[model samples]
Target: MGAIGSSADNAAAKSFNAAFKRETLKGQKGWPSEREARLDAFHWLTRYNTRRRHSRLGQRSPIAYKNALPSTTIALTQAA
Candidate 1:
């Protein structure tokens, strides 16, 4: 994407890691099981993508943003 060791290239990743640490990890030293950790991350990611409000998205979740868009499907054939 950018030149070697570019800050811009890592900006998004850094933001994500910070949020993950703050929200998912919640300062916990460790999980009781590896499966539990994975599941927790999965749940947090799902919630973040579907319910978390993002400023860049006009304070809407990704699912809400998508639902707000107008349909663009072209009609291929008339329905009976």
Candidate 2:
């Protein structure tokens, strides 16, 4: 967003990754098994994407915000 290789470009992504790691890890060394790790990540991602309300989205969950939008239909035309 700012420039190539600029921190601002990936600021949002970095913040999200940090939050995911911090909350998922929870000060633990590591998960006991790969299965558990996968499960934990799955659960966290599910809740994060659909259940959590984001301030930037006006305190609505992503799904809720999307549902609030008016539906649009795109018509396709063949190029002559």
Candidate 3:
């Protein structure tokens, strides 16, 4: 889980759980079937990685941060 701090992370987890339930779980909190939840989870995971805005990263989403960085740094890295 790409969670943050302790208390805040718990709250965030609950938020995602609810979002997952509504968007993917279809309102069922418990899994009547195992793999269905897994499938839903995988889909949400994709969105979380590619779509969510992360505050710690200065509002840039994960995909945005990854793409914005230089792929290969020079000796400037050491100087910094």
Ranking by lDDT: 2, 1, 3
lDDT of 3 by residue, 30-75 (tens): 7767887787789888987888888888798998989999899566
Clashing residue pairs, backbone N/CA/C < 3 A, model 2: none
Per residue, candidate 1 scores C-alpha lDDT tens digits across 1-80 of 45678868777878898998798778898789999999999999999989999999999999999999998989798789
Off by over 4 Å in 2: 72-80
Residue pairs in collision within model 3: none
lDDT for each residue of candidate 2 in 1-80, tens digit (9 for 90 to 100): 56887779888888888988998999998899999999999999999999899999999999999999999999999999
User: For model 3, what is the error of residue 63's alpha carbon versus the real structure, in angstroms, after optimal superposition?
Assistant: 0.9
Better of 1 and 3 by lDDT: 1
The candidate 1 region of ten consecutive residues with least summed lDDT is 1-10
**Candidate 1: Cα lDDT at 4:** 71
Leading candidate by TM-score: 1
TM-score of each: 0.82, 0.77, 0.52
Better of 2 and 3 by TM-score: 2
CA lDDT of every candidate: 0.89, 0.93, 0.77
Positional deviation of 41 in candidate 1, in angstroms?
0.5
Candidate whose lDDT is highest:
2
